[model samples]
Target chain A: MTSHPDVEALAFFAEELLEPDEERTVAHHIETCALCAATLDELTAVSGVLADVPPVPPMPQDVADLLDRRIDEAVRERAGSDDTATETGGPVAPVVPFTRPKKRGFNGMNLPRLMMLAAAGAVVVGGGGAVLNAVMSTQQESAVGGSAAPLLQEEQAEEAVPDAAQPYKPEIVGSGTDYTSKDLADQAADVLDATVPESGYGAEEEAQDGSILIEECAVSLGERLGVRFTLVDDARFEGAPAWVLFAPMGDTTEVYVVDPAGCESPDGVLEQETFTTR
Target chain B: MDAVQELPDRELLTRHTQGDDQAFAVLVRRHRDRLWAVAVRMMGDREEASDALQDAFLSAFRSADRFRGESQVTTWLHRIVVNACHDRLRRRKARPSTPTEDDTLDVLSNDRLGRVGGGPDHASQTEARLDVHAALETLPLDQRMALTLVDMLGYRVEEAAQILDVATGTVKSRCARGRAKLLPSLAHLRNPHPPRDVTTGRGGANPS
Candidate 1:
């Protein structure tokens, strides 16, 4: 009480934060000490100063759009397996039974596969020569037993539309330094291993954890190529930054290394490889 | 659809758990603005705030069934949002950032350049907001969050305690320390009278 209390003590006293005895002592001192009293008043006004400033402008439009898209994707993924009996009246996509083509070879083509072949044939006939060129590339790659085919077939059957039954989205797993063809094969095996145990394929993951630019690239690229990539590795290829995209086929995985800058363009694909799951 | 809009938060959450798909979206639409305010204040950057809010809502949606109705749904949402921001800030701090010029300066200049004739009042208001955010960046995260909830956002101490999952006294003490630390910078901003040349010696205690 004899000397003026410090400013922090005054701040504590204002919030009633001091010990009872100390609170009493400060209270008695500030009663007569004009300087300490003025400091206390200034400290008390801090909140008013802060509150008087206008708040940050309402959420930006792009952020709102991103939020809505993320929420919609979540709703669809959950609705696929949502067991509750209540009829959903919202504008959600009708829940489809989760299906993945098991190790059914070309000889075992079923109804969905036949439908898929019809769809691919239709694409070749109606969609123009560019799509046919893309499909023919897949056909040639499929000719290599170690390369792509069943994925193009499955992508036609499953995600014929960009929004259909996307239980898995591209998620970044790790940096892609020193990734050999062997490493790509090993990663493909891991992706297939992760898919077998659950229909959701780690659907609970924070799938959009990558930067917005990377996510948009993956999505746009998926739309262009007509396949949803399940795993994306931020990669370095030929001493340049690249992205490695993985989509699990029947028993093999299709891997593409693309330049992140021009990800939506066909020229962006720096390399393509496929390896059968062991 | 009109009826869906009229349902209360708890009813919406209950319906969401029971498989009504629209209920959660309606709940989000009703509360996103207020939650956005809390998040923007917690994280000074808009993009980071957006990311945090999305993470929180998705988490809330998934865990709606486990919410035993112990607290108001709004409080629960706020807790998730604050925790999300906390985790991001911790991870951001763990990795040292590359050196760059102050982003707040860029923001202040951009505001001035973008607005043509917003009037002096409008311009100064933006400056004040940026200044406050810059000052807030100096406090420890725990104290920053406490003061943000109690002082800037005007939540009650008890409410802040609930959101922060800390004791009432703990919230009060954190706010006290934060206020003390902020006083020197804020006083310079608020008081038009030029600061005296004489350093009160106590002024040296200012963390910034």
Candidate 2:
């Protein structure tokens, strides 16, 4: 009761959020302490100020028009599915088009995006022909075919990845192999699509787990770039040893090529490009 | 359709679930204005708000049968809208496209200009809104949503709790934390003439 509580405590006091004993203590202290009392008043004034600010103007016509259109789409899609189900008299074909690109050979790969793929926990690749059970929640949710479903599906899709397994072993396509900037997009997608079988590389794989250094570097770059890269190519770009990072953003994937030694540094990203994904 | 306009919210939801197509649109028209206000405050951007609102309403439309009747239809709608905004905000956080700290301050300064120019009341009001929203952007999503519902939209704490699906105490504590965070940035905004030396003035009194 002798010392003035900090502002957070005073704020909690204003909200009656403090425990009874602490509340009594602060209440008694603020009763005599002018500064604490004034601080508490300011906190209350903050809410009052927020309350007094005017409400948003009416919903714009454009937004209303968009909403109506989206709803109409949803209704029609629903009606179509229902009609198809009644006519077929069996399981209805899924209306959601899982827009995955064709299964290209996931050969030749690298490292930065591997960290993110492991991070997203979605693609649990066991081996070649490994049924890469990507949780694919976004596409599946869109399977429900609600018109607004796709707008916020990525968040849920990102969360669907499991955190436990070390099953992801990225194929490091020939370190120091030179890649032309022209073919980098195709090369990046190849790495992104590469998956190794779950078997082999027992203790050696555990040792590679020490690539926590590379993982941390990728994480730092991801934070700086505001992208969780799903694949990284530890290959050479033009001539120098480089790390190519791939991050998917809806219909497009961004590729960042960085110096291996300086990928963690601010000037690490030597080249960056965007390509439309199929 | 005219009669559907008079239906209560729950009645419309019931009818929609029972395959009355017009009922849902009527329900949307009835509450879209208030829901828009919530979304705009939560999002701090009109386009994102519009997207979130559309996402929420369509999700509601598709899932009407899942309505358990434990809460009011409006409460249910608010929950969906808040959740939709939350998801988009989380993803946007991962993208570097959000305005940076310098941009927010630039917005605040320009808002001050609009006020000092002695423009029409409508313009000043709009600037005040911009100032408020800019300050709000700095807060964590949970705190921002709580403050938006309880303080900005003036929902009751218990009502906000229902919409947020949290305890009433949780809402109050979140509002309290948000207010504490907002105080330093916003106190000067309340004063007509902001002190030039912010470091030495009341604006500098950061309690945290």
Deviation of model 2 at A56, angstroms: 1.9
Write one digit per residue (lDDT tens) for candidate 1, span B1-208: 4699998899999998887878888888888888899988887777668767876786677667767798899988888788777755543444425121146556656764666655557676776576667667678889889989999999999999998878999999898888887777676556554236312532322223
Q: Where does candidate 1 stray beyond 4 Å?
A: A83-278, B96-101, B107-123, B193-208
Q: Native-vs-model 1 lDDT? A: 0.61
- Candidate 1 lDDT at B154 equals 90
- Candidate 1: tens digits of C-alpha lDDT, residues A43-108: 777777777766656666776766676566557646643533123221222211123223212234
Best by lDDT: 2
Q: Residue-pair clashes per candidate, as listed? A: 0, 14
TM-score of each: 0.57, 0.61
For residues B1-208, could you state the per-residue lDDT of candidate 2 as single tens digits? 2687898999999998777768888888889999999998887777678867876886687667778999999999998888888766765554535454345456656656556555557766665566567667667778988999999899999999998888999999898888887877665556543334442521333221
Q: For model 2, what is the error of residue A12's alpha carbon versus the real structure, in angstroms, after optimal superposition?
A: 1.0
